[model samples]
Target: MMTKHELRREYLDRRRALTDIEVQESSLQIANKVLELDIWSFSNYHVFLPIQKQKEINTQYLLHILQGKDKNIVVSKSNFEDISMSHYLLTDQTKLRINSHGIPEPDQNGIPIDEKNIDVVFVPLVIADRFGNRVGYGKGFYDRFLKKCRPDVIKIGLSMFEPLESKIDMHVNDVGLNYILYGEEVIDLG
Candidate 1:
């Protein structure tokens, strides 16, 4: 099993190899693909955008404008400059954060939902397999969060590179992505 430190190193190295243009192009493509889905035709979908990194569309801008006109959107609480692999829900008023791990008591202000209400979710990952298994930042935040989400919730993995051959040590609780979007292509895991 690769140690957390080693995995971190490898992930960072691969992620850093991506150029600024590559990242932007990948993100734009992923955003475009998301907009094409018919699911957004009638229902209100909550989009969590990352804060901009070096003028790139970070979560904030992504959530703010990606849905285009006449769409419902919400932004999560800014814990830091970047949001990690966690899940948040949108309410009629605003977006609320949830504790993926039950260990830390969730904030009372967290928006409550029956998971089934969520239609789609976009998850970030350091690396992903062709099978859609993802490796996160060793926090298991997305894994735990997926457990509580509806099985039908479209889980899309966002990354800077194409699928790698490396095997990710996944626990039984680890969640698989339905699709993965990279700079040049989108792989449907379905």
Candidate 2:
């Protein structure tokens, strides 16, 4: 099995090789697959926005579907100072601005949502394994953030690529995903 560092570079390279059109089409497919899941039953959800450069899954269409269902859609911004993320309610009027890392972060003025109230979180990842182990950019932000959520909160990962056949390097502090959606499938690891 490749180490987390090696897998990050390899997966990132593969993601970057995709053309803009391919990214759009694949993202649409992944989004459609997500809609097939029973995740909509949850009234409150936390979604991570796409970082175009990182080739993250485009969640705009998914966000619209969630909004149409009257679900409380929430977004998060990195608190660089604390190295932890804070969740905020995303609304029709929520203004978004790109952060230094090129991620579209919600405005700080958004109403905060307590961690316990979130039913599910659509996670971001650089790579994930069949065992649900995930490797992000090594910031440990999501690891810290997920720890605060309720024990049964469903943690889902949105990946443009499928899970690695082998397990990823998992540490005690790393938080594994319960489900990972990639291409046209949602692999439930829970």
Q: Could you list the CA RMSD of all candidates, in the order they appear? A: 6.1, 1.1
Q: Please give, for residues 70-106, the per-residue lDDT of candidate 2 as tens digits.
A: 9999899897888988888998788899999998999
Off by over 4 Å in 1: 1-5, 17-22, 36-38, 41-48, 51-66, 74-114
For all predicted structures, in order, the TM-scores are 0.67, 0.96
TM accuracy, model 2: 0.96
**With candidate 1 superimposed using the best TM-score fit, by how many Å does residue 152's alpha carbon deviate from the native?**
1.0
Local lDDT at 17 for model 2: 96
Candidate 1 lDDT by residue in tens digits, 1-190: 6753576678767666767776676777666665544456434344544423322223433454444545544223322224333333444554343433312222446564444465666776777778888877666656665676677778878776667766666778779998887666778878
Candidate 2 error regions (>4 Å): none
| Winning model by TM-score | 2
